[model samples]
Target: MAIRLDFQTEKKQGSLLITEESESNKTDVIRGFFSLFGFEKEPMQTTVYSPEIVVHSQGKAEEIQKQVSEAINQRLQQLESRPSKDEVEIKKPELINSKRTLNPTIGEMIGGAPQQEAPPEEPEWYQTGIKNKEGVPHYKLRYWCKNPQCRDRSNDYIKEDQKTVKCRKCGQKLLVRQAADEHMKRDEWGNFFIADKLAP
Candidate 1:
């Protein structure tokens, strides 16, 4: 029934002419060039091909002269660049050891070269008894697991007989003593706040 399109893209004065380059079958010439223009829409990018769909052709451009002679013999066999064995030119080896990481391709089982991330641990201030008024024992903070870049743990303690003051690492309600015997400030959520002027 003489259809059309097998490979196309022509902008002559601006440079994008591919008209059927013998792609042998660039996947059924990109599914018969989008089913000969009803635009089955699959291929993408030459900036999404639209300067009037590469200069008009609602059909009958000699019904794709055999997909334009197999896309002009596949663009003269890709302009005679002839080198492919999958064009052997691979070379990605320049990491000088500054801690080269990125371990992602989970397939052919080639793991084991990225186990060096253990250097960020300095925040464990425990002491939530909360007693701030010139008696010598303070630390009133509670609940700060919001995770601002992690690594803080004031889970605090000291409820021996004050009755209700939790936050042993995010339980939230703390402040069993606050007259300010003074000394404990981890704020911004990690909780623990008794700076009675840094009392003694």
Candidate 2:
């Protein structure tokens, strides 16, 4: 392929200076001028330049340079022109919409909290209390050792019974204890009778 030749002249210090050369014979001219211009500080940084091309049979090299000279001059205009930074305005960040409330219900306040059930109450008929006669402070169940903790069927024995109540058949001396619930009922020959232990 044939090489295209071009020349770049920078407009600085009121006069135009050659910064590029497409002709091989013009190296010394470009280097000396570039050395004075401080090539390191200049905006022109291209090390590789377009080679000066020679046409076969007709036309001068100076005339050949005209076509490519426009391209080099255009590049110099671009570098010399004041390059300004483009201002890109960033969109302000928006606050996310979170759920907030003024007054919340009990369900909302404890929505994620663990639930606890109340302890069960002891039944009146199933609970019986026997006191200590020896001046002990704490009260405990009297006939709790028997199969039926209450004195309804088996022996009536409080923990601190002073005297033993004798059994008629077995002669087993037993302790006398109070009935639970206090509404005691006795049965005699198919007849039912209510005892007054429940009276206030």
Candidate number achieving the greatest lDDT relative to the actual structure: 1
For model 1, residues 55-127, the per-residue Cα lDDT tens digits are: 2234333333344444545556675877877887999887775564575445424765567799877544333
Give the per-residue lDDT digits (tens) of candidate 2, residues 98-199.
556576657768784556878888744234433335665222322212213333333232333333443333443444443343423222321112122211
Worst 10 residues of 1 by lDDT: 45-54
Runs in model 2 lying further than 4 Å from the true structure: 1-60, 80-82, 86-200
Model 1 ranges off by over 4 Å: 1-67, 74-76, 79-82, 97-200
Q: How does each model score on lDDT?
A: 0.41, 0.38
* Candidate 1 lDDT for residue 200: 20
RMSD of 1: 20.2
